[model samples]
Target chain A: MSAPESILKAENLVKKYREFTLDHVSLNIPKGYIIGLIGPNGAGKSTTIKILMNIVKPNSGDVKIFGLDYKKHEKEIKNRIGYVGEVQYFYENKSVTWTGKFVSQYYKKWDENRFTALLNDFQISRTKKVRELSKGMRVKLAMAIALSHDAELIILDEPTSGLDPVVRREVLDILMDVTRDENKSVIISSHITEDITRIADYITFMINGKIHLTIEKDDLLSNWKKIHFKKGALNQEISQTLSNVKEGMFGSSGITDNYLKIKDKLSAAIEKEDIKVENVGLDDILISFVKGE
Target chain B: MIGIMKKNITFFIQYIGFLYPLMVLYWFLRKDSFDLPAIMISGFFFYLLISGSVNILESYEFKNNVYHFFKTLPLNAGDIVRAKFYNVLIAVFFLFTANSVIYSIIIPDKNMQVFSYIFILCCMLLTLNIIAVLYIGFFSIGFNKMGKLLWITLILWLVLTILSVEMYLIKLDANLLYAFISRINRMVWVIVTFAGFASYYGLMRIAIRQLEQNYDNV
Candidate 1:
């Protein structure tokens, strides 16, 4: 696709705690697309999102949402963004309708009709107390509330974790539909790669509080490849060129970003060493990067 | 801020307000005899107990990890702090009014001073609110520390505040302030009331700053 508008940009964002630190993180989120933030536990995915929301003040760095500084224009920026967390928080005894009523007043352009429609679609009872709703239902309820406001961006942290496959798919489908509007964007972080793989347009991989890579999903999928070689056929020179290379008793295996060029250079070696090449998926890419680290 | 107020009120009314206050009132009413001095001391302790316990109850709600939820809504740390401050302010006002009225009826002796009781109530509320501000402000830096330390500190602070306010109310020139309650000029009373309001606003500002700096911890 042609160049799209940049909806979010974070430059060298940093937050430190005794247990962990988010070191010099930056990413650009374009309008009208989904950017999947994928990482293992304690990878700072949640921290990045929190900084964007201005919920957690970063030790240093800048965050711009919709071209405005997040700090200076917090209320304006938050007003136009919808956010959902892995585990929702609400007064357990309060009814869903009370939550809606309480939350709707905060947004300027809240759509009552859209909220009602979403609740109906999600099959959630507005009269039911928050504690009565199942985990999946609570997530759906949060989604409904987020979508009801005419937000330009939706940021969800682990929206599909611990959820059943059917519910996960339903949530993903809803997210996919959300980006249909050209002015809208989404940033969803999840460890479940398949949930993001089906919907993400861009992928940003973070590990150990650092961003490993940020690239378009299509480009990543097209460029990165996995290769296998027969035992004792690989040398240090050839293995150094690949990523996450591992040598086993039976064979050698690795993944590479420069697949085409590497394939051309290793052609002679591939034929001689009986190497097998294959396209890699997000799961493989994540595991390779993590294991490599 | 209004949203936060509504949230806190809804939670309180639905969960604790319905039963807890009635119990406290029952305990207050079942007394065998109505001695003015005993009533004053007991009333102050009972109010402190209620306020402190409710504060603890709300802390449990925060433990449910609702700060993230508040962040998602269109509110900032200052707004949240303001909401909480006002909610507590309103509750304290209601308690003061209710207790003053009930005590006035119980001790129908014209010699018994009502303003002293009201004055003590205001002091107690202000002290408690300031403690809350200090607690929330210090809570962020102590994120890694054990909660027991925080609780112990809070309880200690509560005891200190209760003692200080009690001394200020009943022991500062006892004859002039408490015994000869009518002798205290109108201007002095106005000044004290103004001072109370001023202190509340000042503490609220501090609490707001504390919350802004530590919104993530909540």
Candidate 2:
């Protein structure tokens, strides 16, 4: 069987600033998948997205979208990619309809009727100035523009941050709807792990400008398990495989990333009820990675 | 490129309502005092004012993060710089045309001579405006640094322009000025205009290169 084709590939991107450096970051976004870039604040998630979009030139790296280099195919690549930045910037004095008309001129496949429909669906008024809209409305506006262009890949940076739960859910639902077409893909960066687990097919955790790991969501959840056992019940050999070990008066618990490898070794303990194994979520795994456990 | 130019025209139009009316009012109030020198000085003053107003409006637009918005679009640095250069060219063309029309109506006896002088003055103002546009395109250097540099250049240009005009008014003979204008071949005028446009294009290319190198700062 052949591997799925990638829509966007970034190799060893590095950007240096006085206070922060995006150190040798890399990413691969396959077609028909939602890839989540999860990292804390100032963890280089935004910088990585900016470099991929060619908004910020990297000190050293190669980025190819649709297998085309940015230096030669910048306009073509950008035309096919929909980007919603972390902070939405628009002509604040222009009406929504005017802004839409202005943006539609740049894309070859812009759908005006679809854009108007999205505005109605998103509850955005066509006659309102951008400054008059709320923050959530502004995000919806950005999403409406992103969706109307018929882009092959949608890249969003912190689209759900600072939003109310209702709006956040709506944004996530829109993203999910975008991927209904199997040829499309999305790469969203956020610190919110629950949202990623809910929608992302693959999650890539970044810490301190470096990508710690990228794995399928199901694989990450299945392999990383939290085990609770009494002290001395588990030997040092098994304990060495665990991380974030905490001791309580009642018992002790540790997280394991290779639960399948250690499952057979603990079969005897499981049969005797000497230890309890619990399924771990993406948040726990991210926390363990972030805390350097 | 057309889209960016259209956007710039739309932005400038928003301010034209008040600016154009004020310029006309200034000319009407001083109609009795009109002459070649007075007309030249008025044109220079209005160009300076308009250029300063444009700088302010552009600074405000930058503060509103217009560069960030444009960067997200599928535009290259050349598209942006060319659009801006076209905006200045269109603006200067309209302003000079309007001023000449107003002067022709007010000073009918000296219409031909005033028109010729205004043509020469228009060329000078256009050159100045092009330089201003090129300086404004270096906005990626950081707005504060660009702003300081632009103001210093504008002030120096203003002083030199005023001094040159004052000297020309004081030292020139009317027949000598007329003879100079007539002795100039028509082909030379065409060549000079073409050279003006060619230099404007060259400066625009330089601006585009600077913008591409420092787009992130923008």
**Pairs that clash in candidate 2:** none
Give the per-residue lDDT digits (tens) of candidate 1, residues B78-114. 7876787676666666656665666666655554545
Using DockQ as the measure, the top candidate is 2
The backbone clash count of each candidate, in order, is 0, 0
| Model 1, backbone clash pairs (residues 3+ apart or across chains), number | 0
> What TM-score fits each model?
0.84, 0.92
lDDT of 1 by residue, A15-60 (tens): 9999999999998998888899999999999999989888889999
**Segments in model 1 whose C-alpha atoms lie over 4 Å from true places:** A1-3, A229-240, A246-252, A263-275, B10-35, B49-53, B99-111, B114-179
Q: Highest lDDT, which number? A: 2
Candidate 1 has an lDDT of: 0.77
- Give TM-scores of chain A for all candidates: 0.93, 0.97
Specify the highest-TM-score model's number.
Answer: 2
Model 2 deviation from native, Cα RMSD in Å: 2.6
Alpha-carbon local distance difference test for all models: 0.77, 0.80
RMSD value for candidate 1: 4.5
